[model samples]
Target: MKRRSLILPVMLFALLALVPLLATLGPRSFILAITTRIVILALAALSLDLLIGYGAMISFGHAAFLGLGAYSVAILSSHGINNAFAHIGCALAVSLVFALITGAISLRTKGVYFIMITLAFGQMLFFLGTSLAAYGGDDGLTLAQRSLVFGAPVLKNDVTLYYVCFAALLGAYLLCRAIVASRFGRVLRGIRDNPVRMQAIGFAPFRYQLTAYVLAGMIAAVAGVLLANQAEFVSPAYATWQRSGELIFVVVLGGLGSLHGAIIGAAAFSLLAELLSHYTEHWAMIFGPILILVVLFVRGGLTGLLGGGR
Candidate 1:
């Protein structure tokens, strides 16, 4: 809410917006491509922060929505329906319905039970995706073409798609900032910090938490749509528990409870992985310890170090 609080995210987006231009100075397409992936994944991580950070709901299966969205695009594209609007609509619809059903059942539990239930649901989706033999099944499916905008394959252009994804990340960030600062956000946080107290004051914690869950799922689905386009493929792997863990890591690595921290964390994680992989195939061994150090020492993550852990 403060001007100082806005500075980091604004500057981050500004830098990201310039990346396509910056790419021209070097590896060009490769740099632009990786940057686009980071921005898309950042959007997914930002959505998770809405639940885990502000709402205190740890969903271990959130990536299911991402897989659903990506599959929506992949399936639709395979059927010769390349419309962007259709892909987005189907993605959001499937994720919204799935989140509503799963969140309803999962919200009945608390703490670890809630986490396990979400993970179970996520795995269910993962298996379902695997069983879709019509859509390439466990091997995954490739899109013959990216979604078209007004019959134009605008998203097929790397630079154009990069900018589009950049705008999406920026837009998602602003929308989340608004949500976390709104009356609804207040109710969500109240439920997060003290659910019993909130209920005593006439706020139904289940309703608010479920709403936040569905909202977060829908946002993640948006990221999935972008990711499917970015990769031109959809796989069960996208919805795996491991992918969910990475989203959690991104949120934590950037510091919990801060929206922009999600973006920073995503960038840091992506770049770190890219950098580490160049030296060793088993980069996770080294990357794992760095994450541990961040958890033990960083406290609030990079945002905390930068004094923006709000």
Candidate 2:
């Protein structure tokens, strides 16, 4: 219970940190860039936590949703449909379609099989993206300009874009928190703890799982759209298995099922990567082992290590 108290403080710290990032730093654009990436990834981490922690669905192919979102924005904007709402709608629609159809099949299995099937489907999308030679085959498609909001360029200002991503992160976290506390969430949690018992109670586990899957996919698409806007680009790399792994790692590192934990984990993970890469060219060589050890020794991930508060 005491661990739960850490949630508020951690969130406050992350929020407050942005002030200095936006203010004190010279050429603060770089810092804003870092903050934007962290916020966007934080949203993605929140989406992953919803299904994995609450719904007990482990998917290694989640990055496919990110690709879908990125492409939705890039492709539309490429053809001059630059409205933010249009791109956002396209992203969510594409992600929902894929998640629903795939969840129906993948949720039929359990555990390792579920993971494998999701990974396969995700690869299918990755390859499909690679084949889009017109947009950008092995390479990525770059947006000619930032997306239009109403009429002006809402995403043109780097700082404004950072705040937009931050707001989305906050919204996703709140949405996930509400979901986890709802009547539906209680059933989903029960399904995770004991699907057999949930079935005994006459609940259809697959329906709940699929619902959560689609919701998660939508959330991921939100992150993906923000990512495309930030980079002003979209690529097949967005759907790579390694990218999916990093997302899963974010959830586990944060302490599964804890919304605050996911945010903390994402911030820490992104900041660590940014910092470590600056000090060394082969940062992954050092970072990977550290993560391996954390997974090995700190079974609770960040929350477990910190004795996670609320």
Pairs that clash in candidate 1: none
Best by lDDT: 1
The Cα error of candidate 2 at residue 36, in Å, is 0.5
Q: Give the range where candidate 2 is weakest over 10 consecutive residues by summed lDDT.
A: 16-25
lDDT measured at residue 165 in model 1 versus the true structure, 0 to 100: 88
lDDT of 2 by residue, 1-310 (tens): 2555656646554774475455555767777877778778878888999989888899999999999999999899888899989999999999999999999999999999999999999999999999999888989898998789997997898878877887787778777878888999999999999999999989989889999999999999989999999999999999988889999988887778877777767878988888899999899898888778878898667877776654
Best by TM-score: 1
Off by over 4 Å in 2: 1-10, 13-17, 20-23
lDDT of each: 0.93, 0.86
